[model samples]
Target: MIDLGALAKITKAFKVIDNDKSTNRLSHAYLIVCQDAENLEGYMRYFAKQLLCSESVPCESCRHCSLINSNAHQDVFFYPTSEKGILTEDINAIISESYVRPIESEKKVFVLSNAQTMNAVTQNKLLKTLEEPPKNVYILIGTTSEQAILPTVKSRVKKVEISPFSKTVLINALIDQCKDREKLENAVACSDGTLGKTLALYQDQNLKNVIDLGIEILTKMQSSKDVLEYSTKIIKNKTDLDQFFDVLDMLLRDTLVKECGDQSLITNPNALNQLQNANFKNGALISIISAVTDARKRKQFNANQNMLIEWLLFKILEEKFRWQKL
Candidate 1:
C-alpha cells in the first residue's frame, strides 16, 4: 500500500529517481538522506520500485512493485537486519552477493539502511562494489546524516536529500486523521516540516501539557530553589525528558525571535504574547539554547537523567540572573 499520490505531495525524492530512469542515466549507487527515520524506509522502497518497475513510473500493480512493497522481492535486498546496525561483516556479505544475477527483475537493488552506522572500516569495505558495481545492480544507502559518511564513499553515489513537507501539504494529508484543528496546527508548527514528527505530536495527548510546562518554566521559574521542583515534574523518565527538551527548545527559539522584533518569523504564534513578556536577554537565550544542546548530547551517551535535568535547569537560571543584572 504505497500511497504514491500522498508521497508525491509530501516529497520529491521519488521524482528524482523517476527522472533518472526516464533519461536512462540511473546511477549505480544512490545516497538517500532524510532526517525522518520513520519514513526513510518508505522512500527507499519507492526508489527501488522506480528502478524495478516495468512501467515508465511505479504503477503499484506490477509484480516488481508488489514484491517490493511486501518485502518479498528476491532481487531487492535490505541490509543490517539487526538493531546493531551496518557492520563490516554485512558489507562483506553485500560485496560477496552483489555479483550474482537478479532473481526476477532486470536489475538488483541493495538497500543499506542507516548508512551513518557504517564506520570508516565498514564503509571502506563497501568501496570496491560501489566502484565496480555489477551490471544492472543498484546500491541504495539511506542515512540521517550524510556528513557521517566518508567523502570517498559519498563521491561515488548520487545523493538525494529529502525535502520537508509544506504546511499546506501536511495539513491536507493529516486532516482526515486529526479532527482537532488547534492540535493539528500546533503539531504542524512544531514539526519543522517533517510528517513523522507532526503525526507523533498530533497523537501525543500530553503535548499541550508539556508545552504549558515549558512556558511556565521560561516565564515563572525563578531562583535555584525552583530547579528541583521543575526537574521532578519534567523528568519522570527518558521519554518525558525528550518531550520537555523539544518543547523548551521551541519556546526558547520563539522567544528569541520575538525579542529580535521578528514576530512574523516565530513558529508558535499562540505563545507569542507569553514569549514577548518573558523579557529574556538575547545573550541569556543563546546561552540557554547552547546548554540544552549540550544536555541532549550528554543524554545520548547514557548520562544520568536526574543529574542532567538539574544541571540544565541550573544553567538556565544562572543565565537568567546573570543577564538580568547586566
Candidate 2:
C-alpha cells in the first residue's frame, strides 16, 4: 500500500486528479512539463506509486512501495536511455516494452524524464502507442515546457504544469544542502529557482567555478578582445556545456531586468555597478542574447566549442553601443 499524502503542489494537481479519480479519470498518457525538477519528479513518483500499490488508493507502504522505493518495481518500467535526454533507440525500446504485460502489478508505468529530448522521429513512433495505450498502461512524459515537443504527441496526453519554487524557497533548499553561503547564493541566482540544476551546481565544483567565472567574464567584456578572452577561458575549463549555457542565460535575464529598471532581479548585485558601466541598448542586448543562445545550440552538435564561444563573444564585442554614458 502507498499513502498518497497531499502536499501543496500535489493538492493543486489533485483537483484535476479528484475530478477523474472517482471515474478513474486518469489519462492513458500524461505530459508533465515545467522548469521545476523537484515538483516534476514528485508528480511522476506519485503517479507511479498509485498505479502499483495494491491498495485502491495510494499508500506509501506496501509490496509495491518496496519496489518503487528501491526503484526495482518490475511492472513500473522507467525508460532507459544513455544520457540526460531521450534518443531514437530509447523511444523504440519504450514502444517494445509497452507490448509486454505487467510481471506482477496490474499496470505497467513508463516514466520518461526529459521527454522534450524525444526528437520528431521518436515522437512519431510514440504517437501510435500513446493513442492506443494498452489497458492498465500509463505513459508519463516529463520535460521543460520551453522545448518544442511534437504537438501531435502533446495533444494525446493530459498536460500538467509543475511550477518551480520561488527564489526564496529555492535559495533555502540550496542553503540546506550547501555549507558555503556565497556558493549557495550564487547557485540560487544562477538556477533561477530550479532546484535540480541548483543542486547540480552545488555538487560539481567545476560547474560552480564556471558560474563564478561566467559572471566575471560577462562583467569584463569591455571589447571584442575581452569577450574572446573570456570565452577562451570557458572553453578550457571542460565544465558541463549546459552549465555554461545556464550562466549565460542568467546573465541575459539579469541584463533584461536591469534594462527594465528592476534592479532586484540582478544576480550579480555587486556587478550591477559594472553592468551599469557599459550602457547597452535593447537592440544590443537582444543581439548578445541571440548570439549566446545560438552558440549553446551549436555546442550540442559537437560544433567547435572554442570557435563557437569566441565567435559569440565577438558578436557581443562588435556591438559598440555603450550604455547611455553611465
Candidate 3:
C-alpha cells in the first residue's frame, strides 16, 4: 500500500480526483506523468482505491481498499509489464475485458504501467476504449515520458504531472525510516530528489558502496595531477556505472554550491571541509555541473555510456585546469 502521507507532489491531483468523485464527474481515463515510471504506478493504484472505495472514498477501512492495496481486487486490473513494456496481447486483453461490469465496486479501474513501451499498433487498439469508455470503467496510464504516448490518447485523459520532491520535503518524508541524519541527507542527494529513488538507494548496500567509491574518486580528482586516471578506472567498473554517475553529480554539485557560499544547500554537507578547500572556482564548478546535466539528458537517447562517462570526466579536468595555467 502506498503511504498517501508521502504523496506531497500530487496532492493537488488528489484534490481534483476527490472533487470529481463528489460531483460525479470523474473522467474515464487518466494519464499520470512522472520521471520515475515504477513509482508512478503506485500513485495510480492509490487513486484507483480512492475511485473504487466502497465504505467511504479512499477509506482504508473499506474491503475494496483492502483488496486493492493487496493487489487482489477483482475490479481493479493492473497490467503486468516491466522493462520490455506492454505488448499487443496485453492491449487486446484489456480491450476485451474493459467493458465488464465491476464485481465488487461501482467502478472498474484498469491500471497500466510504462505506457511508453506500447507501440503505435497497441496504442491505437487501446484508443478505441479511451474514445468511448464504458460507463463504470476507468483507465490509468503511467509513463515517464508523455511524448511517448499517442497524442490522441493523451487528449482523452486527465493529465496529472508528478513533480520530484525537494530535498527538504523528501527528508521530512524519509526521516522516520532512516534515523541517521547524515545517511538520510546522502540518500536524498544520491536520489536526485525522487522519494522512490531515495528509498531504493538507501536500501541497496551495493549502490551505497558505489556512492562511497564514486565520492572517493571525486576527492582524488580535486588534487590529483591525473584526474583522468581515477575517472578511467571508474568507467571500467561498468557494473554500477549509473549509480556512480549519480554520486558523481552530487560531488560536483556540492563543489559548485560551496564555491557559491551555499554549502548548506548541498546533499553532502559533511564534505564541506573538502569542498571549501577545493582548487576549482565557480566557473569550473558550473562547467562540471553543466556536463553532468548533459550526460544525464543524453542517457535517454541511448548515448554510448562508456564514452559518455569518459567524455564528462575529461571535460571536468579541462575546465578545472583551464583557469589555473593563467
Cα RMSD (Å) per model? Answer: 4.0, 6.1, 3.8
Candidate 1 C-alpha lDDT tens digits along 52-147: 987866788889989988999999988778899999988888887888888897898899888888999999989989999989889999998889
Worst 10 residues of 1 by lDDT: 1-10
Expressed as tens digits, the lDDT of each residue in 71-105 for candidate 3 is 88998888755557788888888887877888887
User: What pairs collide in candidate 2?
Assistant: 1-59, 1-62, 2-58, 2-59, 2-60, 3-59, 3-60, 20-25, 279-322, 279-323
lDDT ranking, best first: 1, 3, 2
Q: What TM-score does each of the candidates earn?
A: 0.76, 0.63, 0.80
lDDT of 3: 0.74
Q: How accurate locally, in lDDT, is each candidate?
A: 0.82, 0.68, 0.74
**Highest TM-score, which number?**
3
Clashes of each: 0, 10, 0
Residue runs of model 3 more than 4 Å from their true location after superposition:
1-5, 8-12, 54-57, 81-85, 206-225, 235-239, 258-264, 294-314, 324-326
Better of 1 and 2 by TM-score: 1
**Once superposed on the true structure, which residue ranges of model 1 sit more than 4 Å away at CA?**
1-5, 8-12, 54-57, 72-74, 80-105, 116-125, 145-151, 163-169, 185-193, 222-228, 235-239, 259-265, 273-276, 281-284, 297-326
Better of 1 and 2 by lDDT: 1
- Writing each residue's lDDT as its tens digit, candidate 2 over 171-285 gives 6545544888767766766675556666766666775577667666665667766776687677676656777777777766677787786676677554344455555677777
> Which residue pairs in candidate 3 have backbone atoms (N, alpha carbon, C) closer than 3 angstroms, thus clashing?
none
